[model samples]
Target: MSKSGDDQVRYEPAAPKKEQGGAQKPASQKSRPLLEYSPVYLLVTIMLTLFTAEWLIMIILNMAPGIPQEWATLINALALTVVIFPVVYFFHYRPKVRDLAELKRVSLVLTESERRIRSVMEATNDSIIQINEKGLIVFWNRAAEALFGYTAKEIMNKKFLTLVTSPRYYVFFEKWFRNELDLVKKNHGDSMGQGQFEVFIKRKNEKVIPVEVSLSSVWLEDSLHTICMVRDITIRKKAFVALKESEKRFREALEKVCMVTAQVEANGKIMFCNDYFLRVTGWEKKDVLGRNLFALFIADKFHAALKKRLYESIAMRVEIKQMEQEIITRSGDCRLVMFNTTNLLDHKGRVIGVTIIGEDITERKKSEEIKKESNERLRKANEELQKAQTQLVRSEKLASLGHLAAGVAHEIRNPLNIISTSIQLLSMEERLSPETVKTSRIVMEQVKRASKITENLREFAREKKPEIIKMDLHDFLERTIALVEYEMSLENITVVRNFNSGPIYLLGDEDQLAQVFLNVIGNARDSMNEKQEEFSYDELQKRGWVGQLVIETIVNEHMAGVRFRDTGVGVTRETKEKIYDPFYTTKREGKGTGLGLAIAYGIIENHGGRIEIESDVGEGAEFSVFLPLATERNA
Candidate 1:
């Protein structure tokens, strides 16, 4: 007998039927019979028939009245022996011999099948055990012996449940076994008797182990028996526990990390978020998870672009590194965040989602902006300080020059008076010729020019403070322009007035400001005249060279400004440095004393005003005079 595919026991003939001399019988010799004859029935029938025949023979011999009794008995014995012998040989002995041979063949087949089954039970890794209906262990294979540390001789015929199950599980094992047996009986050893369960079993050394047991029941030699396949499960249980522990630790670490972290689906829905993410965004976990990432955290203005970037990264299976973005917090404040993203992939390397790590950089960005502003302010302050320093140095140089001019003017004045007296006396002589008188007049003119130069030097050295009063700057400029109007027209210079519509009131001395304006106009007129002289009449016409003096008044929050723009050959860079120095001139001989601009600069400084010059050699020049507004000074 052997187990089939469905685990059902079956038996097959070990060898086919053979004829005499161990040769297989031919197909022609094999035939089906209409009736099967039993040896016992044949023997009984033959005996009955022989007995009747002997009785009949005895009767016949008696009826025949044989001549001699001995002859009749011998004849009867011979007939009966011959008939009985043939019938028994053909009917009983022959069939019995054939039946015995068939029984031997069946016994050989059963022995071979049993041997094969035993070998299979011994070779399998799982422990195989057999228990009878009485709860006694009937079979123990080699694996069972190794697993339980018991030999077959020691464990056989022992109570399996008592020996293998712990005391605490005795009742359970007994109850379970009883139920299984009942179920097997009810189903007549059907597949319903087979099942599997896990349990803790004790070995012979009293060590306990986890095991999985598969049970099956079958009828063996007219008795119910259960076969158990036991497998050790200690390693599997340990590995499962280890995996759970690792997962728990990973989750804890994610929650406690310092940076924001989140898992988002490809569609932009947030799946998981760590504690830091919620803390930074000022959102609760319940409110954040499963919400759309863009809608919840990203501003409306950035929603479309951020969503597009996210989808594109996922589609391309690429990571996003160091992307700066601004997020809206729960309190309606905006925060700058730096994010790094990685794609989450499945086992097949297909994109499933994305993981993002973000760092809040709002404070850092603010600090950078503040530092940049501080640097800009510092630069402007340094420029202003340099300008002040330059002004101070220039002021010191002018102060020394002023003292020198005062001394020179005093020394030259005495000589100029003496020369004037002499020239006048010479002109008074009675016999003076016309030629002599002309020469005397010329000498007087020269002496008077010298006197004017000395007077200018004295004025330049004077440190008189201006008498401050509120005055309309526009009116003051118009008066100053009136003084030079004739001179400018004679040179064909156009005076373009661009004054403000409203009056600009400033605090400055009328006389001092007028002098400053006259000096600046004089310089502009001379520069244009010089430019005109550079070309002839026809050349000037061809070049379209026209002298223009553009005067404009500008008012700001705290100052009133007057600008003088000239279409003239502008000052050179070398000339601009010494332009405000006393006795320095870029004019022809006898044209100017050059004390005019020096005096103008000192008066403007005393009035708490500044003069700024902007010029390029060929481009023309602009002079802007700025003074504090009367209202600003009072305030």
Candidate 2:
């Protein structure tokens, strides 16, 4: 009725509470006896009885001697009117009217209270419900309807426990409700006659939601009632779980990081450090916390520079990156560290501290120092070695040239002596005979032979530059193969061509490459022919030996290659090593000059190519010539 500063009014929608007893029976059953007694009819019957008694009394008086019937009747009527009417009207009828008026007033007040309660319940965000002692739902508000997905009509008169309890929570509700009822009954009208708890309620859609509930008990019409104020806590629960998970992930990340990470105050006091920082610094977290970071860890030489950087980073808000410095550890050993530092800011963007992330680079620094020293040593050693190798190569070249000159002179002298003898023989005759004419022709042949040797020597001595051109290696190999086909066939040799269809271009002197191929192919054919002479065709077939030359064209990332292989007696290791040397021929006298391979080697070298030979004593030899792939510049 009165509002106070400290007191607040709260409205709860009244619903039937679950009780130990069963559901409330209908009002008709309780009102049946009262209806039978009908007060209006009872009053009428009493008046009739009084009137009948008066009439009888008047008759008796009239029948008696010396009595007046009219007088008796009048006297009885007066008595009835005066005593009975006043008594009935004042005591019964007036009281009934007054009681009815009081009942109407109370009903109006109850209705107004209920209407206010409903308005408050609907206005509040929380779902409110009141349950009565009979376990029947007497109230369901708009908030409750929205929360539970059931309208007030649908939920009204239903048992409270039926809406909230499932089989899973039946035992829990039973115990909880028993306890709550005990409290409500024991503290019937106490100020703190309430209990709060959390439970899950299933909505009409069968969706379960967690709710925080505050309960209050009140006496309504001499019966116990329980009010529940429920709030949905799903969002709060999710946020709490997320915060806990975020904390866990933060701790895990700090533990897993490999670098040293630390936070420091602007004054260089260490505020926090991760696991790696503690381990790397050889200090416990407690030992390092609140200590001056630079004084404890940084070497003295870097103190000034680091302090300057720290000041700049915090004051100017500049980040220092990849600063290489040395820090002394607890064991008094200096470690090289590469660290980056940035200012840590507060919500207002004011610098609060600094964060330092560093990696231990001591071992790397040592390795770099060692590598630098070793590189210096290796460079000096290499220079000296190169000089010595150069001198040795020059000496060997001179010696080889001297030997070649001697061989050339000896070879030429033989032909020259033969020509001289032939000339002398022809000069002795004025009219030369047939023998003399033959001697003259022999002289001419010897001179031609000497000239041919000179020409080969000249070619060997000259250095020819390659006129580089872009050409398909396969096509070149095919053309070279055609030139040697007839020769190989004459020796009963089979030339097997293995060439990829794709074009493999190389920058080279095509003429020089052709000459190289021709020389190699000629050697292959010669080798096979020499082998054929050693074994009969049928015998060679029986031995599974065939005069075969395999020419394979191959390409790789940097070079294109052509392989020349011959199925003949391979050269010995000793002869193979010297096969590319000048004047080293295995051919019979006058059949070869031994300059073909030497020229091939020089030509390939000038074209920036490599010629590699693979051979065994019994197996055939393979010569792979690799020329660099042509580039746009070379083309």
Candidate 3:
């Protein structure tokens, strides 16, 4: 046996030598022969001894050969066999068989142990690896293969630190291993410890992943080695990062919103509040947190009802949307607010709290109240104005009737006097005489004049809406001028038309416009004739000016205009003001019923138009008529 009582051929750790209590261990030591105590050496020695014995038997048989040669050879072979059999059986064959049986048993035990270890390692989701004393990977499991994109054969004997992406972590692992080894050695063959650490590792494809490693050490064949159970935590890390980003976004949004947002516990305690909530309630976050929501912000009068509603909504999991309530601010001032509230749920979907989003509405409520009061005032004012307008219209109507009655009585009196004088003359004649005939003719003429006056009154009183149609103003005026052409020529009046070259289309009653034009032209002719009587013919001839009537058609953005200007005795200011009044005129008796200008005014007004007269006595008059031009919508 070896002096140390250990098999010299087996691998062993070099022991540290000591010289007394404080001696340093020696570094160099002589190595022992590897095959000195092997079973193979014993077998070889036994085989050599048997071979020498057979040689000796052969020699003896040759020396004592009195028998036959063949018999001697047979005896020699038997002796060799007899001697060799026992020697080989006892010294070599038996020992070899027993050793083989032990070896097979040990092999089966080792195979079963290895199978159980592999099964355990493969069953787990975590990657399992083992590294030797030199940091070389000695074992890699199925999970390790999937995690590192490597197979056992590919990674065996490869340095484990090669998979670590960070050099700092690699150095730390080496130092930690050395420390653990030193501790284990100092502990007299005891394991240092088991521990966990995080590190980034690179896969076969050069992709980096975060992993957690649980490390354990073992003494194998007198050498210390480490076993690592690594877990890929990349997905968990991503989830954590995403959760942090989502929280950041939520906080940013809450800070930017204008409405008050807060979370309240089921007991009405404020758990969380946004910046807007603190600002609106005039309270700091420290003052609001953990305070009772109803006792702090809600008015005392609304506290009971609001609490009841909140409890009901929580129990039913219902939302209260756009509900208005009065709240008391931190300054003790009441303000109206609208609140949208809903249940705040946990991960299990169970309602544990309430979320309130509220908007301040005090100013809006005040504005609505003020608007209601203003509307009431406006309604009363409108009623008073309507009454005043009604009284004014009635007074004006009465005055207008009085003037019309007076004018009619005066106009008919002249005609009636003419008829009465003519009748008296006829009665005095007594027989068929020239004076009687002349009186009959005068009576008929006055009767015709009265009838004409009645017709003019009928036309003036009749008020009918004009039949508006699209008509060209110039063409309509030309037709009216044709009707008044003979009258203008008899009065020695010249007519001048300055018409717009472009078509001046207007939506108006053609017949009504024609009558208006004819009346205005006839007025111009009469004005000239009245002035002619005042002037001597020789003086008029010396002036070298015939009565002139100018007609013009014009077009502009909004309206079409027609102007009739005359060189004659124009009207006074008073006459111009009353010119459009019904039954008012300046013509001699029996020459006019005084309804012409008024009739023209009514017709123009019905067509959504206007008339303006500019006149001065003995200077002639100008009449301008304006009508709204036809538009796409009007057409």
Report the number of the highest-TM-score candidate: 1
lDDT of candidate 2 over 451-477, digit per residue (tens): 777667766665567888888787777
Off-target runs (Cα >4 Å) in candidate 1 are 1-279, 284-294, 298-325, 337-359, 372-391, 423-449, 489-492, 534-546, 571-577, 585-591, 632-635
| TM-score, one value per model | 0.49, 0.37, 0.34
On residues 284-358, what C-alpha lDDT tens digit does candidate 1 reach at each position? 999998998888888889988888898899998889999999988899888898999989877578999999988
- Global lDDT of each candidate: 0.81, 0.76, 0.79
Candidate 3 lDDT, 118-198, residue by residue in tens: 578778888988787889887787899999999877887799999998898877788878988998767766674788988
Clash number for candidate 3: 4
Model 2: how far residue 560 lies from native, Å: 1.4
Candidate 3, which segments miss by more than 4 Å at Cα? Answer: 1-431
Q: Compute the lDDT of residue 36 as modeled in candidate 1.
A: 55
The runs of at least 3 residues in candidate 2 whose Cα sits more than 4 Å from the true structure, single-residue gaps closed, are 1-434, 437-443
